[model samples]
Target: MSGLLCYCRGGFEPELAAELGERAAAAGHAGYAVTERGSGFVRFLTPAGDAAGLSRALPWRSLVFARQKLRLLADLDAVDTRDRIAPVLAALQAGAVDGTLAPRFGALLVEHPDSDEARPLAGLARALGNALRPALRKAGLLAAKDDPRRPRLHVCLLAGDHLLLALGDPADSAPWPMGVPRLRLHPDAPSRSALKLEEAFLTLLDDGERARLLRPGMTAADLGAAPGGWTWVLQRAGLQVSSVDNGPLRQHVLDGGGVEHLREDGFRWQPPRPLDWMVCDMVEQPRRVASRMATWFREGWCRQAVFNLKLPMKKRWLETSLCLDIFGREAGLPLELRARQLYHDREEITVLAIPTGR
Candidate 1:
C-alpha cells in the first residue's frame, strides 16, 4: 500500500512520524511511519487494504506536527536528468487517485524538503511547477485556476534524480508549504518574536474561531514577557494585556497604555478575573510548561491558551507526547488542542488549547 506523505520542519521528523502513527492508530487503522532526522518529512504507511479510505478518516485539525498530509501516488526512481518532466507527467496520469478526484485538480505545488541539503532545490521546484502547470492543463489534468472544491497535486523533489508524487484535499491541506504561515514582523511591534503569535493565530485557529475568540478588547496575559514580543501581538489584537516578568518589558509596550507591565513571577501570578486568553512564551522544561498551561484550563483561569514548549535535544517526540497526555488527563475537559513547530520557532513548538464547552 502507498503511504501518506507529511511535510514538516527540518530536524523534527521523529516528532511528526510519532504523531501521525499514533493518530492513525487511534483512528482504528493502525500504521507506522518512516522517518529520518533532519529530512523534514515523514511517511505513514497505510494498511494493505486501507490506503483508499485512510485519508478520509484522518482528522486534519487534530494533527500537530504535520504541516501537510498527502497520499503518495508515485515514487519514481532513477529519474532521467534531462527528461524528468515527461516521466513526472506520465506518473501522475497513471497514478491511482480517488474515482471522484480523477478529473479535478485545482492547484499544482512543486516542493522539496526543508533540510540543509535540500535548500538549493527550492528554485528548481519552483521552476518545475511553472513548466508543469501549463502542460497539465493542456493535458486536461489540471484546472485553469484554483477551485476550492477540487484537490491539489503535490510534486515533491527527493534528490537530483528522484521524486514523489502525491495528492491532497485543499480543504485539509496547508495553504503554504510545510504548513508555515508566511508572516512578517511588524515594524512597530516590540520585537520580531511577535510573528510567532501572529503565525499561531493564523495557522492553529480557523477564521471562525479567531473571529469569535480574538475580538478587539479581549483580555490577555503574557507570561515571561520581557521585550514584549508576544505582548505586542496581544496588543495588536486589541487585548489589554498584563505582561508578567521580572525583567522590564519594552518601553513602548508599557507606554501603549493597553498593557500593564508587572514585575512578577509568571508561575505565581494570577489574573484578578478569568480572562479571555493567556499566552506563554517562557523558556522552561517542556513538561513543566505543559502542566502549567493545562492547570490554567483545569482551574478555569482562562478560556483559551497559546504557549510554547521548549523541547530537549533527544527523545523530543516521546517527551512531548507524554506532556500533552498528562495535560489532557489533568485538564479533564472537552478541549480542542493543536500544536506545531512554526517557522519562527526554534528549539520549541507552539500549542493552542481551547475549552470547547467546559
Candidate 2:
C-alpha cells in the first residue's frame, strides 16, 4: 500500500500518527500509522486508493500535529553514496510525478528526519538537490522555469542509506523545511514566550492580513501577562497593551510605557472597553481556556485572538479536537479558527481565532 508521510516534532510520533490515522479513516481512506520513537516523522499507509489522491482528500488545516505532509511516490533502499544522485534521478523520472494531476514539479526539496543519523544528510541534500533538479529537467520531468503553483518533489533520506521520495501539493503542504522557521528572539523581549506569537503570525496569517490587521496603535490585552512575554510581542507589533496578571511584569516591560499593568485575574478580568486583539498563554485546562476565548469573540470583546491551550498527558489530539469543537460552537456563526503545535510550545498548542461577522 502507498502511504502519506508527515514531518513533526521529535518524540511526537504517537500523536502525529494517531491523528493522521484517525483523519485518514474519517476521509474514507482507512489507514494505519507507523513510526519509530524519536524518529521525528510518521507514515500513514492506506490499503486502498492512490496515496496522492488520499493526501489531496485530507484537510491540511485540520491537522494539529503534522508539520509537513507528503504523498509517498517511491522508496529507495540502500542508496549508493558514491553516485547517490543517479538512483534518485532514475526513480524520479520513472515514478515521482503526481499521477492524479500529471503534475510538473516546480522544486525539488531534499529532506531528512530530525534524528541524529538523518541530520548529517543535510549536506547530502544540498549536494544532490542541485544535481537532481537538472537531471529531472533534462529528462522532461521538470520545467525549465519553475511554476510556483506546481507541486514540489521531495526526497527524504532515512536513518540509513535508504530514502523515501514523495510529492506534495503546494497548497496542502508546508512551504518551509520541517514546518519550522528559524526566528531570532527579540533581544529586548521580556521572555522567550514571544516566539510563539511571532511564529503564529508567520504561519497562520497571510501578508495582506498581517499588514492590515496588525497596524500600529491598535489596542490589545494580554491575559496571564506576568513576565510580559506575549505583551512584549504585542507592543513590538505596535499595539497598546493592557497586561493583566496579579504578578508584576518584567521591569523593562513596565518601563516601555506602552503597557498598562493590571493586578487582576485573567479568568475574571474584562477590559474597560472592547479591544482590537487579545492574547493568552496561561497554564490551565485547554477546555477552560477555549471556552473563555470563545466567549471573548461571542460577545465581541475583541476582534481577534491568539491564545495557548495546555493539554493533558494523554489523548492530546482528541482533547484538542473536542476543545476546538466546543470553541467553535460557543463562538457561533462566521468564525475562523486555527490551531498548531509551534516549535516554541511544550505540552501545549497555540490557537488563532477571528470572528467573521455578528
Candidate 3:
C-alpha cells in the first residue's frame, strides 16, 4: 500500500481525513483517505508511485490538522515479532533499488499512532530504534551520522505486526517525534494555558522568524488575560504587556513590572497606540473573535497577533474555512496568517497573523 501518512490528535482523525482529501484534490491529486475513528493518523491512498508526487504537491505548512506528513513508501503487515527490523529494512532497500528512495537516509524516526490503544507500543518503538539504527547503518541504508538536509525515514507502528515505512522531508515535516514537542509546564506560569501559546510559537514560527520577531522590549497586549497565562509567556519573552480582562490576574504575572493588569472587557479594549503585538484567548464565538481580530489589523492597532478560535463540536472544517474567510476578507490587508490545531488545544485552533507591506 502507498500514499501519504498524516499524524494528528487522536479524536481529530475525521477532520484530518477530510482536510487531506480536500487539499489533495485541490492540489490536483486523486486520492482517498483510509482511517478509523480516533485512529490518530490518516493514510491518503494514491495510485502506486504517486505518493512522492502528492507529498511534493501538498506542503506540510498548509495542513492545519496534520501534525506530521510523510510519504508512504511501503506498508508491512504480519511481520514476525522477533525479526520486525527485516521487513523495514527490506522495504527501504526495495525502494532504493527502485529509485523510489535515496540510497541512504539522513535520519530514522520510529513512531506510533497517538492513541490510547497504541500508547503501549512506545517502548517497542524505542527498542526498535536502538535495534534498527545499527542494522540500518550496517545495511548502508542510513548515513554515518544524522543530517538535517536529507530525507528522514519514518517507521510508524500501527500495531505489533502492522507498520508503515515512509519518508519525511526535513524541510517541510515537523521536527519533533510523533509530531509532538516536548514542552513542560513552567512553575511560574499562572495556568496550564501558557503551554498552548508556547507550543504555538514553536510549531507556527521557524527559528529565524522567532529570533527576528520576538525581540525583547517589544510592546504587547493579552486580551482576556485573566489568570495571566498568555501574559506570562509574553512577559517572559521580555515584552511589556497590557493584560486586558475584567477578571483578576495572578499577582506574580503583574509583579514582573512588565505586565499591567487592565480591568476591561477584551473585545472593547483597544490599545492606546499601535503596539508590536496583540494576542487574544477569549472564549467568545469564533466569528466574533475572528471579526475582532480582523479589526485590529484593519485599523492598524497591532503589527502582529496570535489568537484562538474555539471550534464547534460538529462541522469543524466548515467552521474553520468560514472563520478564516471572514478574518482574511475583513482584515483588508495582505497578512501572513498561519494556524494550527495545536497539541495543547482541545476543541480550538490557534492562529498567528502578521500584517504585510509595512
Residue-by-residue lDDT tens digits, candidate 2, 24-83: 777788789889878988988878746866787775666788778888887788887677
Candidate 3 wrongly placed segments (more than 4 Å): 96-101
Task: List runs of model 2 lying over 4 Å from the truth.
Answer: 98-103, 143-147
TM-scores, all models, native as reference? 0.94, 0.92, 0.97
Ranking by TM-score: 3, 1, 2
Better of 1 and 2 by TM-score: 1
lDDT of 3 at 109: 93
lDDT of 1: 0.82
The candidate scoring highest on TM-score is: 3
Q: Could you tally the backbone clashes for each prediction?
A: 0, 0, 0
Q: What would you estimate as the lDDT of candidate 2?
A: 0.82
lDDT score, candidate 3: 0.89
Candidate 2: Cα lDDT at 114: 74
Give, for candidate 1, the lowest lDDT window spanning 10 residues.
95-104
* lDDT of candidate 1 over 1-358, digit per residue (tens): 5768888888888888877777777778867888788998888887664665677667566676777878777777799878778887786666456423355588888888878878899988988889889988988889988876787888888887888888877777787865566777778888888889998999888889889999988999899999899998888788999999999888888787799998999977888899999999998888888888888888888999999988898877788788888888888788978887777888788999887652
State in Å the error of residue 170, model 3: 0.6
Model 3 agreement with the true structure over 1-358: per-residue lDDT tens digits: 4688999998898888888888889988888999988889999987655777788888898788999998877788999998998988887777632265556889999999899989999999999999999999999989989998878889999998998887888988998999989999999999999999999989988898889789899999999999999999999999999999999999987778798889999999998899999999999999999999999999999999999999999888888888999999999999988889999999999999975532
Candidate of highest lDDT: 3
Winner of 1 and 3 under TM-score: 3
